[model samples]
Target: MVKCRALKRLKDAPPSTPSKKQAILQHYMCVSPTAKQSLKRQSPSLSEKVLENMKGFIHETKQKRNSDARNAMHVISASVSGEKISKGEKSKAARKLGLQPRRLSGGQRIRTSVLRSEKSCYEFTKRKTRSDITSDETKKQAYDFWISPTVSHTSSNKTDVKRSRIGPNEYVSHQIHLLEKTQTEVFLDFKAKYPDFKISQRLFESYKPFFVMPVKQKHRNTCCCRQHIEVRILFKKCMEFRKNLHASNLDLTQENLPVFEHLNDICAETVCDKTALHAQCLNRSCKECGVEKLSFNDNELDTSRNARDIKWDKFEYTEINVKGRKTRTKLMLVSKKTKPGEMFNHFKSLLETFPAHQNRANWQSEQY
Candidate 1:
């Protein structure tokens, strides 16, 4: 009875405030169906107002939710149709629709033309093997070229330094052959000769025989003529001095001017007709290819020191008494103040002193 009086007082108030209307709606919602009917009977106008406000609020909320869904759908459709939609906008739409950002759309596949162009631009060299070179004739040709006498020469000391067994009770002793030119130079020469031949540098190197090897410094003869050595050194120094003078804009006398400047032009024109070693040009005998002289400057040859005074050493086999037995052993023979010319004269004097029969066998047996 007390609640009924309070409700009556609220309804009889002068004007219906929002707070009063909200309280009345809350009360209607909390009451049972039978209680609601009783309340409606007591205040029919207040029940009608509460029902109308609830219906309008529900309608507006449903329209807003539907409009958000439509906008999200439009954004997704635009992205799929190739329209310019940024990832941020797409993610925003996805969030409005309550979906993961990445899951909003499927990724587009790359174009076939683009993939082809990428494949064409990217290059990789395939490794080559002996099997790739299937021509036996080509291999034979390369082998022949490498083993030619002009390209390489057999060592004079033919005693088998290395021996390898190929079969039972059979052995092969290969003679060492020294290469005149480097392997790379030989390959370049071969390529020049056979332009059609296709070969890699590695493959060309593999074709070299096991016995053939590069010449070492120790194998080279160091006993060069002193006169020739001095001439070469003088010429090199003159060339350098001439270059420095020319760079500094200094004038050179007629005698100091280069004499063989025209040699390069002459050789370029007649090189094809010349021999392999250019013997005619070197001999200065051929009318078409001879050179009279080659002088860099009018520098006099320095001849104050005796050529015989130059001390040098050479590797030679010397007969030595080992355990009272004469054994030939390799030794570095050092000659003091004795030039090659004097040594040759001494050898001739020894031959003249000994008889012809004794000279042939015993002369070489001497330690000196």
Candidate 2:
């Protein structure tokens, strides 16, 4: 296995950060002379492993200390209202709070609301899930917007106008046009010139035509907008295909993706029933009594601890022919939890199970 590079401790960390070996050597001074001699006496090569482990432990300790200091400083600063917070202090506080001081939105560094407590942040995030984009009616509107070749100003029907408080204005039209032609920075610059256009990001989603695909860093922001729309439509079709397949009780032998077989199956002792309502129960409902709880399952416990080790770059995608005159669809590659590093060709024989043209035809038939 490839080893991870050692993290530098804050004390030894410099403007020009020292290498792993240099950092380890610098930290060796903290070890008592007797302890160092004992490590050398155990085995000449053993000291290297001991030093490596020590380096990791020291780095973690430094990080914890820094975090504690930040939290204490924040609580003190927030409670003392008279103390003037400078730009530098404000930026530091924002970093500590896991917030952006100014986010680039609609072409400006607009200040976002700061939440004082974790409970407030959680509540704010929970409210965002109720966005109109997730509503079935809004999804139908989005589908209509997707099918239209050009964004015209003719969508003034009651359904379209009633969805958003601020209906389609000239500024919104201009913003959508900018999204089609330029990057986010250019769109923001355009909005800056028009002070009256005070549209929020949420408002943009309400007007279906104003939907802009985010430029992802994975593609270095060079993702083809046309292809992005095609893939998105394909994903929607895949969801429909999966639902129909499951409803029909059809076996998924050909389309089966790699998964943790053990994790998918419930433990024999775990079974929730009417009895669970009044008693300490098994079958996963009661964490204290459930047989399948992480405390009782060692494998699951270990997997949960190491799950975050999966790297973002390891994520893979492929195109497979799924329907209609060799029309292809994108599939995200997921690793089996049991054997995370094991590679297998699972999609080589999967067939086109859904009629793609049927959905496309339905969209085309709609009058916008």
lDDT of each: 0.48, 0.34
lDDT (0-100) at residue 199 of candidate 2? 45
Instruction: Residues 2-46, candidate 2: write the lDDT tens digits.
Output: 233334353445545458657676577556797677666874478
Question: Could you tell me every candidate's TM-score relative to the true structure?
Answer: 0.26, 0.16
Which runs of model 2 end up more than 4 angstroms from their true locations?
Answer: 1-25, 28-366
lDDT tens readout by residue for model 1, 203-278: 8777665567887532342223332233233334334544654665557643555422321232333223433434
Best by lDDT: 1
Residue 6, model 2, lDDT: 37
Error of 2 at 272 (Å): 55
For candidate 2, report its TM-score. Answer: 0.16
- Rate residue 327 of model 2 by lDDT: 53
